[model samples]
Target chain A: MFLNLIRWFRGFVVFEIMGRFPERFINLSTRQGHFVLFSRPRKDNFTAALLLCDYRTIRPIARKSGVRLKVRERHGLPFLLGKYKARCGLLIGLLLFLIITVFMQSFVWTIEFSGLTTISQSTLKEALAEEGVFVGAFKPTLDLSAVQRKIMKNIDEVGWMSVNIIGTKAEVEVKEKELKPHILEANVPCNIKAGMDGLILSMNTKYGKAVVSSGSAVIKGSLLVSAVVENPSGDVSIVHADAKVMAQTQRTKSFVLERKGVFDKPTDEASRYRLRAFWLEFPITATSVKQSYTSRFETKSVFLNNTEMPISVTVEHCSRFSPNIYSLSQSEAQGIFAVEDYLYRLFSLSECESINAQRHYAETDSFYSMDVLYECEEDIAVYENLVVN
Target chain B: MNRKKIKSEQDKQNNSFGFNIKDAFSLKPRIEIFDNTSAVIDGSCGVLEYSETVIRVSLGELSLKLCGRGLTLKCISPTSLIVGGFIKSVEYIM
Candidate 1:
């Protein structure tokens, strides 16, 4: 394939050598140390293809050997390009296409990430973009090892990483750092106390002496189990306390909701397109919205033969809309309150054996106020480190 | 001028490198054929005849004839020639 390309680049001609003895012409042409591509004997004449320069040099040799050389065909790059001299635009367009293809290869189009969990893809992309390895980034100017080091430095969660560039695509592989668990020291003396103010419902004492019984009201920091263990033989010892103290608790919260607000509704969307060639991105057209508008950016990458191209299309869609005033209806306010009340039940009162809730709402001319109360039974066991005095 | 004196004189002029010492100090022409497909002739003076199936080269004392199908002269330098085709046979004419 490359040989034909090279042959075309250097123009060649096919000549028909006809005379008394074509062999003499062929021999005399080569006897001067000139190379002929090929010479085949026909019925009466021999046809040989030679470089155009060689053909010009061998004209006298043909005459001296009594053979007349008639050029049968002219081919190669110069002749092919000369045929289209009249069409200047096509030639210019071809040149431009070649330049664009070369330029597009110098940018990174698609970035692929693998071996990431717990850590987000956007976080790593941000870190990589800071280190010059993002989409539309110039590929040639990137220092891959430096990019890896910077990314590792920027994100503490990423323990190790590598950046590999294959054509227009950048492949990023990462291993996330594992967090070590905090474990309390064993055989340490401790005490169990009430983490919140609640009435004691039950007790499960595993170690130490129980200080509070069922149905006893206790406040925060009130010890339910003591680490001082007294033996029947009149000997006392300190031990690590372990206990589960179930309690009934009550919680109250309030929220204020505004009565008036404005929200936007998208009316008409206009898009601005940009052509991205590697590191260069230029707008094809600009769109201006007089009203308030929100923009959404999207990049469409081009691929050839499963390999990504650095060329891409960036579209910024502008949704032109203005905010309209609307007051929150009573039912909408109630809906918001119901949602908040449900969250409270799900998060605050979670794992409770039994729960009772009361909701109150007070409305003024300007805003609405919601008060939520939750009554529930849960474990309020808290471990307190013993102070050695 | 007896036969023995003539033999002794010819022996004195014999060349160790030239194969054709009898041809009066003429070096031997070398013809190499490759798998009946191509032929290379060294020490050839010029081409005498050319055709699609036959090519005759002059080697000072004899003409090196090549018989083949679709024969073509791949190279024809002053002292060497290369023939490319399906070569049927090669002959050296005295």
Candidate 2:
């Protein structure tokens, strides 16, 4: 196989020897250190292939052996180059295509991440971009080991990370650290204290000793249950204080709004598009935006034959707006206060047993203020650690 | 040659128990027949006669006649050659 390739590279000629004793020509050529391949014999003529260099020197042997040599076919690289020497542009284009394909393979085109549960992809990509592993990063210049070490060191959540640049795709695989429970256990020795100043409605003590009885008035930061239990013999035992103390609490909060409210109003809107291939971006639509405008961005990747390419299209929709002040009437001001009171109750008193609210409205020259007094019954037990040194 | 003489000659030439000059240096023709289908001959002298049903190969001291149908030389080099065909018989002619 290797000899055949060398023959094709140096060029070879298949010729026919037509004479009475062409077999003698074969014998003569073999004796003179010439390799004759694929020798096929006819009645008085035979065909065989010889290297182009040998063909030039074998004419004398063919004559001496009383045989006439006629060229049958030609092969190999020199003949091929000679046949298409006039069409230089085609060859140049073929070479240029190879050079470009090799050059383009050195840059990263696509980036993908796997094994992400708690950490967001955008946050990781931002961190990766800061570490020089983003899309369009030069593959030869990238130290993937260093990048992995740096990312694993900087990000506390990533337990294991691997970056592989295969062809044009940069695949990042990550394993996040399993999170531990943050809530404290009930077995720890602690005391239950009153969270707010209120009248104690009920007390349900599961462990330790209860210090406050039902219907007792207590202030905020007052201890409702003690972790130290003592018997009649005066022997003391420290245990975890577990109890639920329901209290009727009264609190007042003010919701204020100026008569003239300032809000951003949209004045105009504009849209533009950008095309990105690798790191180079080109604007497809004219860029238009106000000095202070909110924008929405949408990006879609380009695909060819169901495979995602490096190119993408980004559409930016900007809404131009300016701050405007409008004066509110009496009815509008009352409606706004009603909404504020409803939301405060819905969020703050959702877990209460019962709720009673009283609204007091007051208006000044510049603003409107509403004071809401709330009374609700809820569990007010809070844990306080006890140091027994 | 007769089968017994040919077998003895082959055993001596290819796998002799003692030292042999022609077998050691590969100076003479070596013929290997594969179940009568093809023959690989090392030290191929030359093609003496060619026909569709018969091929005469020179082996210096002896001439080998291969009788078959559709006989052709698969490949030929200076020292080695392979003959491929359906063989009815192989004759060692004097």
- Best-performing candidate as measured by lDDT: 2
TM-score of 1: 0.67
What docking tier does model 2 reach? acceptable
Which residue segments of model 2 deviate by more than 4 Å? A1-20, A42-120, A138-193, A196-202, A206-223, A226-242, A246-270, A284-294, A302-311, A322-378, A382-389, B1-71, B78-94
Per-residue lDDT, model 1, residue A42, is: 87
Q: Put down candidate 2 lDDT per residue, A1-389, tens digits, no spaces.
A: 99889999999999988887766777678778786777776655678888898889998998898989899999999889889899988899999999999998999888889999999999889988998987788888899999999999999999999999888889899999988878757678999999999999999999879999999999999999999999889999888899989999998989998999789887688888999988899999877676688898999998877657889999888887788999988788999999988898889878888989988999999899899899999999999999878
Per-prediction share of native contacts kept? 0.77, 0.26
Q: Score the docking of each candidate (DockQ).
A: 0.51, 0.31
Flag clash pairs in model 2. none
lDDT by residue for model 1 over A1-389, one digit each (tens)? 89668878988998898888777776777778666667888898888888877887998888898989899999998788889889889989989999998988788888989999988999888888878788788788999999898888878888999999987779999999989897755589999999899999999998989999999999999999999999999999998888889999887889778899788777788999999976678999977665467888999989888766667899988887777887998889999988988887788677888888788998998898898787889899999889889
Residue A340 Cα positional deviation in candidate 2, in Å, after optimal superposition:
9.0
Q: For candidate 2, give the lDDT of residue A297.
A: 95
What docking class should model 1 receive?
medium
Q: Where does candidate 1 clash, by residue pair? A: none
Candidate 1: residue A292 lDDT (0-100): 64
What digit string (tens of lDDT, one per residue) describes model 2 on residues B3-60? 9998788676765456565666867778899987789988878777755578787888
